[model samples]
Target: MDDDVERAARKVRDVEQAVSEHVTRGGPVTGRASSPDGAVTVVATPGGPPQSVEVSAAALRMGPHGLAAEIMRIADRAQRNANTRLHQTLERVVDPRELTAMGIERGTDDDESGWRR
Candidate 1:
């Protein structure tokens, strides 16, 4: 029993190490989305940050509040997309269940409460 526990711990550690290394070597994961009017565009990366945002000249016509709302909406969608892609990519490197066991959320875009870390 003790040997089994030790082996399991070792395996978990190995998996964690591999995941870290793979992430370190992998390219940044990003997702992009634009407003319905094509006035706002956002490129977002996993962990909830916009890598870049682009606004068209037409966006200025929407007024300050309207443009800000559009940008926020687009950025949210882009972040969700990036998270989905990140989860999918991680699935290629590790079992989905393993990822969950390691505290990585594997929720879909529709799952608003998912993706906690």
Candidate 2:
């Protein structure tokens, strides 16, 4: 029992260190996308809404409705991209079994709870 406790504590410490490294140096895992006509671009970070958006002068001519649609489309793509990157990062820092225990499948975009589930 003592050995088991020691092992578990070691695992926890390792996980904590890995998480710290990820946060301090791994950088933000982001996803990015652009409009079909290349007039708009969007970037998203894990567990958050879009972090940045860029619209070219030509995109302004798209008007309200067109611009809205394009933005939505690009935002969706960016979110998916961010999710993928976030998962990859997590895989590197977290134990696969722990993620599985939490019902987080590898490569799945179902992390609607900001990196939870």
Write model 2 residue lDDT over 68-116, tens digit each, in one string.
9999988877777676666666788787677656544345554332231
Candidate 2 lands at a TM-score of 0.65
Estimate TM-scores for all models: 0.65, 0.65
lDDT tens per residue, model 1, 28-84: 677777776679988887776798899999899999999899999888877777767
Q: Which whole-number lDDT from 0 to 100 does residue 70 have in model 2?
A: 93
RMSD of each: 6.6, 7.3
Pairs that collide, model 2: none
Summed backbone clashes in each candidate are 0, 0
Q: What is the lDDT of residue 95 in candidate 2?
A: 70
lDDT for every model?
Answer: 0.75, 0.72
Best lDDT goes to which candidate?
1
